[model samples]
Structure formats: structure tokens, C-alpha cells
Target chain A: MNSSLITTKTQRHKEKHYEVSAPSVTQWWSWFKDHHEDTKSTKKNDMSSDGNNFRSALVIGYGNTLRGDDAAGVRVAEELARRHPALRCLSVHQLTPELAHDIAEVDRVFFVDADAMADHVYAESVEQTPARSVRSHSLSPTSLLSLARDLYGHAPRQAHVIGIPAREFDLSEDLSPAARTGVAEAVECVGAMLERS
Target chain B: MTKTITISPVTRIEGHAKITIALQPNGDVAETRFHVNEFRGFEKFTEGRLMWEMPGITSRICGICPASHLVTSAKAGDDILAVEVPETAEKLRRMLTLAQWLQSHALSFFHLSSPDFLLGFDSDPATRNVFGLIGHDKELALKGIRLRKFGQEVIEILGGRKIHTPWTVPGGVRDPLTAENRDRMLAWIPEARQTVGIALETIKKVHAKYKNEITEFGNFRSLFVGLVSKDGALEYYDGFLRIMDGNGNTIADKLDPKKFEEYFGEAVESWSWLKFPYFKQFGYPDGMYRVGPLARVNICDFIETPEAEEERKVFKKLSGNVGVVNNSFYYHYARCIEMLFAVEKIEQLLNDPAILGTTIRSQASINRTEGVGFCEAPRGVLFHRYKVNKDGVIQQANLIIATAQNNIAMNRTVHQIAAHFIDGKKGKITEGMLNRVEAGIRCYDPCLSCSTHALGQMPLHVELFDANGSLLDSVTRS
Candidate 1:
């Protein structure tokens, strides 16, 4: 099978383009400034106002893009970012400790990741897991929430793990058929959750 | 019966690895080995790709220090193109390199190693982590996180994203630094400075507290290697190579980084996937030397930044007239000092108006078939060498990563800590003792991801085997 046929949207974005100009520093600064202000205002609203209306949401989709099927989470995040320009989305290789700061500032957060053991797309509430002396390169969603509350004294009132079923994880930019379907389902599920919230 | 104890997938480091200790019939420590079991084959797979694509592809080798690979790989491309990047491009690359040093060092000191210092080494396994540090000192934890974030933001300001940025290309960077972005980075200087200050003071307290660990944790005579400025000041972006003996003598100096292969040799062992790098003159095993923060600090004659220079004075005193700090445990101290220097250097670079110049790249085709790029990664010196055809497709690639260079030292460290903490006579090892062994490895901050081109998740699993190779006991932590 041709690898390009199975390439995910995320991989297309990552394709080598030597002629493409780098993003403008000025434009990025403007966006960053606006995002900072939005975060502060949303945080204040979450603290003072009734928790029901004007809630801010953050979607963190993390996995290895080069690994087949592991790119599902990032593909879902790219789709969400395209569909809802107002929503804040982050696609990362892995979850790290610094992510807690983002998790603490929002009212709700969805941690999207590819799960090798899962059979289908699903979302489950994430509980704070007790700290353990594990590797620091990557963190589980539960441990990250625990870190948010412990360090910043704040965690999203609602947190969840959106697991996209994955099988192949070989060194390739393509996604498995199952993962491609899972990405779509996960994106729809997260969109519905964001709207209801 | 004799037995073997294995600590697989060592925790708090960048990649997957294990340590095995063989015991004599009397239960005395006989031999120890550090094994890197996983392999991603980046060197092998990168072949046949265009030289221009290398900067992006190689940067994915390790998530913890992608910028290091990105910058070094770009330097290799510069060599192939035979073009001197514009002045502004050089400065921009320097800024990005320092930002990476700041963030990577912060991650090493605060998130990974601090728990061992702030919380007791004997602390419960479930609570001896960054989360535990937060419960103990919220202010410190927040400062660490923010400091790291500040560095990441600088990278984002320069490149488009925080991780895996392809903004750096062959011959030069993709963009110039804008005034607004430069000012935003400058605003972070004060807090970054303060956090590094507090961290330095805290590490001193840790040094005073663990006097025994200071002496026994990988403390021995070995050569130290790193990059040094023309006048022998601390350097990260670019410089010639320098190798210093453990007794504070400069054995080799003013050697071109491009000729690194002439001085250093890589030796492979059957038990591990990671190669052992040694000084050529001294030979293998016996030629073993240390790299990274400890080596960088020992090698340079001085640091240009005022605050860091002052700390370097204090750091040198740790050697007490011998001149070179040999203890692997002091890697944390050296790392904090380097962070201070990185912040100071970043501020200086940002103040230069030349950083805003428009001429950032020099376009060229493959003028050279083989090119070697070398730079000081956060951990230590990193080299990226490539051989390409006239059409620019890579024929061969070699990556001498910092972690692989310290492989022999890490194994020695594991043995030293194991021997000191574990009394084989008792025939049992406590979790604390095991953690101390891991802590010794953490001092080097080995990124097996870079060393082995790592794959898969790393969870620590220690197993014990009797003389007949029968499993006696085991412990696993996820």
C-alpha cells in the first residue's frame, strides 16, 4: 500500500516544504498576546461567575506523529483547531509537566491520546492519581491533573481522557484504518462535549 | 549461590535502560553493567534522505532535546552547502541554542533530580517526584515550571511551535527575530535569573546534606571533554574542542570540531545497544571520560556572564585545588550555573540590534560530499556527521550523542552507588538503596532516546536472579 494514501492530516501538515516561509514573528506575537489575555479573563470568569456559562475549554492532543496510528490524537486536534477557530488546541509529542499550567487555567480540559489497548473511541473522566517516582519524559493524564492541583492550586473542574483506538505504531507517518475512524469519532465526541459545556 | 540484580528501565531519565550487578558467593559486588536495550535506528533509517531534510528528521530523535539535534543538524547542512550563515542568522541560532539549554537544564534540575535533593532519597517511591516537591514547597515548584515555560516560549517566539520546530533550515534559520518577540523574551530574564539563584542555593544545601553521596557517587579520575571559546570561556553554540584531564591539565586544545573523529573513538559492547565513546589517545574503557555539565564546567577557563562566572569560582572550589570537579553528583550544581549563564547570554543576544537584520540565509547547493557539525548540547558536546552524493541524498550518517559518550561513566556510577548502599552480605536491597543507584545515573541526565534512538515507554523493573539463572525476586514500577 502507498504510504501517502494512509497518511493522516497531521502528517500532511508535517510534510517537508522547503519553500514555505516560516510563520511571521509579529503575527505569532499578536496571537500569543490575545491568547494570554483570553486565558486570564476566562480564568477570572471561572473563579467569580456562575460556573455554567462562558466556560473556556482546552484540548491537548499528544502522541508521536512519526509512529503509525499514534498520530490519531494529533489529527483529531488539527481537525478541531480548523473547525473551531475560537477553541485553544495543542498538539504535542508527549505530555510533560509544564502542561499543568495550561490545565489549571481552564474550566475544562480534554487530554486526547492514542490507546493501544482500546477497541473504539471513548472519553473517560480523569481522576487525580497519586504521585509516583516515574520517568519525567512523559506523564499520564491523571498524574498531570494531580500536578496541576498540587503546584498551581487549581485544576479544571472537568477533565477527561479521549482515547483513540490504535494498533500499528511502527516508524511511519501513516495512520491505521481503525485509528483514522477513531480520530473522526473522537473529534465529534469532543466537539459535542465542548458545545454542551 | 552467586546472584545478579537488574534495574531495568531506570526511572527519571530520558530513555529506557537498565543496570545489572553481579554478586560473588560472599554476596560482595563483582561486576556491574549499564544496558541500553531499545533501539530506534535513526542513523540507519536516515540514510537515502536528502541532506536538507536531515535537520527536521534528526530533531525527532529525542523529544527532551530536539532543539539540540535541530541546531546541530542544521550546522551539518551549513557545512554541506559551504556557506557562512549571515551574522543575524548566527546570532538567532545562538539565541535558540541558549533557550534550549535553559529549558533542558531546568527540566533536568527541577523536574527530575530535585526530588532526590529536596525529598529524602529514602522517601516513599509514590511521593518522591515533582508532584511531591510541589506539596513540600509550592513556591519553588511554580518557579521551576515557569522558568521552563519561559524558555519554551522563547523557542516558540523564534520558531512556530515549542517542540519539533522545523524553522531552522540548511544554511540559516527560516525567520528573523522581531522587536516585539525579543522584548517579550527579555521580560523573562528577571524571573529566570531569580529561579536559577534559588536553585543554586538549594543545591548547595543538598551538597552539604549528602556529604557521603558527594564523595562516592561516580567520583574518580577521568578525562573531561567539552567546547571552549577561542580565549577558553564557556561556549555552547560553536567553538573548538578541548579535553582536560581530571587533575586540571589541558591535554588537548585548539582542535577543530570538524576533526573530532581524529581525537575520539567509539567502542561497542555486546551487552548494550549504546556505544561507548572514549578519547583516542587514552584508548577504550581506560580512555573513558565524562561529558555534559560537569565536563563543560571543568573544561572552560572562565564564563563571560558575570553571575555565572562568580558561581563558577565557587564551583571550582568543590575540587579544592585539584581544579576539576570530578563528582558526578555536582552535575546538578553545574547545570544550575549553566542556566544562569544561558539567561544572561539570552539577554545580551536580544539587546543586539543586529539580531533584527533581514539577511538571515545564504542559499547554496551541496558543495561538499561529507560534512561534520558539532555543538555543545545541553548535556554536552553533540556531533552530527553526514556523507552525501552530488544530488544531496545522504549516503551515511553518524551521531555521537552526549549520553552515549557518558555510558561508561554511568555504569561506573551505578556500580559505585550499588556497592556503597547495598551490603550484599544482607542478601536484600531496600527501595531507597535502589533509588540512590538510579539517582547516580540521573546525575548525567542520560537521554537514552538520543543514545539508542529510543522507542517505547520506560517503566523501571528490577529483577534478581540466582546462580542458576533462576528468578529469585523482582520489583516493577509503572
Candidate 2:
């Protein structure tokens, strides 16, 4: 939704396929650092800051694994678990209400999901949204954060969404080549974010 | 002049559905139809796949009740293999099934339907949700979330993942219950029990408050169908098919699930993708029966657990002389009772020493060309039938989904609520009135995704049209 923060592109494969170029790790880190500082300066009361240090972090990567590139989020979480065993990572089909408790216990949280309409992987800070009607079984990341604050009276000091660009969402377990590449980039970006935190 | 009120993409349920209410010249409801709009050809597409891959593949049919599909598919595979699953494996499978029931029912009650009861049905559509529940009673909301999480945790411990785990296999489960995981499950029992108990009390108050709505919301005399143990006790995992009439008479007992097609028939409607399943003896609409929590509690003679059995006694009294609770709104009440039973049953299963046994799976080649597996899913009775070749490649697959089994009844429920709430003469409808109609469908907690095997976005759009088919009034909610 934030066009300025997102960089979109179009690419052609065997068939003309629209693609989003992934932001380099350095560019992503720079954006995140600036956004982090902006949040601290603008909303001091909102962040339970421990002098810019987060004690614990949780990564919830959720999407339908059975769907094609929709599995990008879960694949990223699974890869993160395999690569960084010490990190607390959960790969679920969708975000449900119970995840609020998990989110409340952490100082920082990253919600990774596949962005079907996006051309490239993008990360943005998340803010708690007012709860509207729950139209479906699944909850959005902002809604989950709201639930965490409303039900548990505790929310992560920092929350962000790392969306992997995904196109194919048909009934298949394999990710698209573009999505696979996006997953790699997203994972590296999240890993760097974790290190910086 | 005739009028039609269409509610598209019915909200708060698992999948995409629409309800159309036809109003007669006198402003009376003429007919109501619940139309499931999406279709996933799981039955047809499953052909040519090896029998062993079914549990994993069919499990993907729904995120809400994947465990039910997983377990039922495995049972079908077991029949193809013609090998009796190990005793420990059966116990583990039972635990997983109960866990599925707990979580799925909790979601249906607390997250989906509770807003209608806890907050008045006429409350603001924006605030009438789980979020509203959190604002109104934070502790209750927390308990509901934790209760559902407890069920998912038990499932994760058994199947290795919360959703769509392929741990249950053809002969048995893929893993045994380790003591460590068993301990984790045991630690959750007390809180889970307390939450269910609290929910039960809350539903009782809701029942008392909405006495008039209860009788009008799918309150009809049709046959109730579910699986009952050999001794006529409540059963979920494996049992004989039991069909009880509205008068509480057992019309059919000890029916073999393998011969489900002979006794049960599926009728198709041009309007909806969901099939209407009926009792073959009664035929078509006359044979209309309800399944799911309302039907399950009605058909079962007794529950094995102590606390749940006590609640079942009070639940039965709601039917008065008829001896069956026909009011579908009581589906919420029955769901709470079942959750209590699931928690107690989970504890009982955990305490069983044989549950920890190591011999989980049995290996075997194809022994039969056809197999049928039936179980009581969280929604209702789920049947998976498969036909295979000598090499065990699937040739045909037919699934009798629980939601589809209640198609006729859901339509009837929509009609009943529409007639009671909406007035065609006024040419106007309130949001509360429309919500009551949708709430009737929610009683069944119909999983359109599992029934139709298709998942899509859900939003509510209501359109009112005159006999000439010109739009008169419309309301949209997304």
C-alpha cells in the first residue's frame, strides 16, 4: 500500500511474466534503520525500548504451503529454522488468534507472508489496527498484533511484515522460480534485521 | 409480486456461500436456498495417485479440519491395505481426532458464532466479532484463544505440525506418543477443562436469552445422523452409523459404514456446489437430516466422560418429550459440551499406558480394490471412499463432507430465519435482521472449503429485487 517504500518492476521469462526486483540487503537495512529511528522519535511511548535492543524475537511465516508460490512465507521460515536453529520460527498455514500470545511474549516480531500482487520482496513496519469484523478464520498481521495488545495487554515493541513476491498460487507444493529467489532475498533481509536488533 | 433477497458471500464461516430468500406476494418467505459457489475437484483429481498419498493430499482440503480428513483418509488407506492398525496407533489417532474436534469446535463457537450470542445479534456489525468479545470480556477471549491453542498444541505434538500434518498413515500413525509430548498434553488438561466449563455456562445464558430465536432457527423434525459406538455411546474415531428420527426413534442402527452408499444417497441441486445427502429409505427432501454437533449429540445415547455426560443430560432435556434437541441454535451448546468431552477424553487417552507403545504402523500391500472410511469430523460425519487397482493406484474417490450432509437443513434454516426477521412488505431490512439469517447458517458452522474443497474470500452483500428483477435495495459488508 506504501508505494514510496516499495520498488516495483516488470520482467519477462519464456512467457512475459511480471516480476519485482528484490531490494539489496544493504538498501533494506538502511531503510529499516531509518524507519526504526523515525518510529522511536515520533512515538516514544509506543515502543518499550530497552535502548534499541530486543531481548527476544519471533518470526511467524504463514501461508498455504500446498499452494504454489504461496508457500514462500513458510519456505522462508523453514529455511530460517534450518539455517539459524537458535531463532524461534513458526511456519503455519495461516495466522490465527492464538498467535497473539506468542507475539505478546516477544520484544520483536516479523510476520513473513507471500504478496501475490507484489513484484519484489518488501519489508515494512507494522502497526496495530483497530479490530473490525473477523470475516474469516485467518487474521492479518495487524489484527494479530491488535489481539495481542487487547487480550494480553502486551505487544511486541517492534513488528514488521516481510512479504515475499509470489505469483503462482495454484494447487501445487512447488514454488515459482521468482518466488524461490524472493524467498532467498527475504530470508537474508530478515536475518540481517534479526542481527541488527 | 414476488421478491428475492440475496446475501452473497456469507461471512464468519469457513468458505464462500450465498443465501437467497424468496418472498411471496404476502411478504411471507417462500423459499430459501444456501448456494455454495466454489468447487475444488478433490474427488476427481485424486484419481491415479497412489493410495498411500491420500492422507497427505486430502488433508490439504481444509485448514480448519485437516486432521479429520487426514485421519479419515488414513482409515480408507487402512481398509485398502486390509491391515488392522496397532492398538497404540489407534489410541494416538483417537487423540489427534479429539484434538481436532476441540480446536475446530472452539473456533466455531468462540471466534465465529459467539459474537452473535455474547454481544446482541443486533449489535453493530463492526464491533460484533472476536475483537468485540475481547473488549467485552478479555478473560473469556483469552481463554478461548488458549483453549484452541491447547488443541493445536496436542495436534502438533502428535502430528508434528498444527495444520495439514501427514503423520497419520495407511496402517497406523507415523509416530508414537513420546512421554515428553504426553506430559505437555497433560499439563494443558486442567485449563482446557476450565475453559470449556466456562463456555458451557456462558452458552446456557445465551440459550435462555434467545428462547424465541432458538425455536425458529432450523428447529425442525428431521432424522439425525452420526457415528455411535457399538454400545450406543458417543463416538468420533470409529463406530457404527446411527440414524435417529426427530421423535428420538432409532430408524437405523449398526449400519455398516462400508456400505454407506447403499443406505445414503447424494442429491444435487443446480444452484449450489454442495451435495445434499439423505437417508435413502425416506427419499429426497423428506429424508433430510442434520449432522454436526446438534445431530451428533442428538444421536449419541451417552457420552463416556463424566462432566460431559452431565451436560449432555441437561442438553437432552431441551427437546422435552421429543427426546432430541431439534433447535440448531443449540449447536453452539452442543459444541461446548463436545469440547468438554474432548478435553476429558484427551486426558483419559493420555493416561492410557498403551498410548506410549512404540509399534505404531503396520506395512501391507493392497488387499482390496474398494475401501470406505467414516468418522465424526468436528462439523459432523465425514466419509472417505476410494477405489483402487491391484497396484493401489486410486481409480475413484468420493467424499461425503459433513457440511454437505447438512445442505438441506441449512437452506431450511435460512428460510426460517428470513421469514421471521425480514418483511418484504416494508421493502426495508435492518442489518440485525440480515445477520440473524446468516447466524442460522453459522449454527452448522458449515465449512464450505471442506465441503466444496475451495477457498476464497468471504464478504456479505445483500441485494433486494422485485418480481421484475430490478434491484430495490442493497447492503454490502466486507
> Global CA lDDT of candidate 2, please?
0.83
lDDT of 1 by residue, A31-109 (tens): 4344444432444433423333224888988777767787788888888776666677898777778899998998888
* Per-residue lDDT of candidate 2, residues A55-113 (tens digit): 38888887766677877888898877766655778987677888899999998888888
* Decoy 2 TM-score against native: 0.90
Which pairs of residues collide in model 1? none
- In the range B1-478, model 1's lDDT, one tens digit per residue, is 5779998878888666888988876777889899988676778878999999898888877777788888999999999999999999999989889888888888888888998899999988777888788778878888998998988898888887745757888889998888888889989999998999999999999999999888889998889999999999998989888999989999999899989899999998999989999998999888898989999988999999999999999999999989899999999999999999999999999998999998999999999999988788888899999999999999999999999899889988888888888776555657888889889999998887643111234556788776666777789886
Alpha-carbon error at B131 in model 2, in Å?
1.4
| lDDT (C-alpha, whole model) for all candidates | 0.81, 0.83
Backbone clashes in each candidate structure, one number apiece? 0, 2
lDDT of 1 at A119: 66
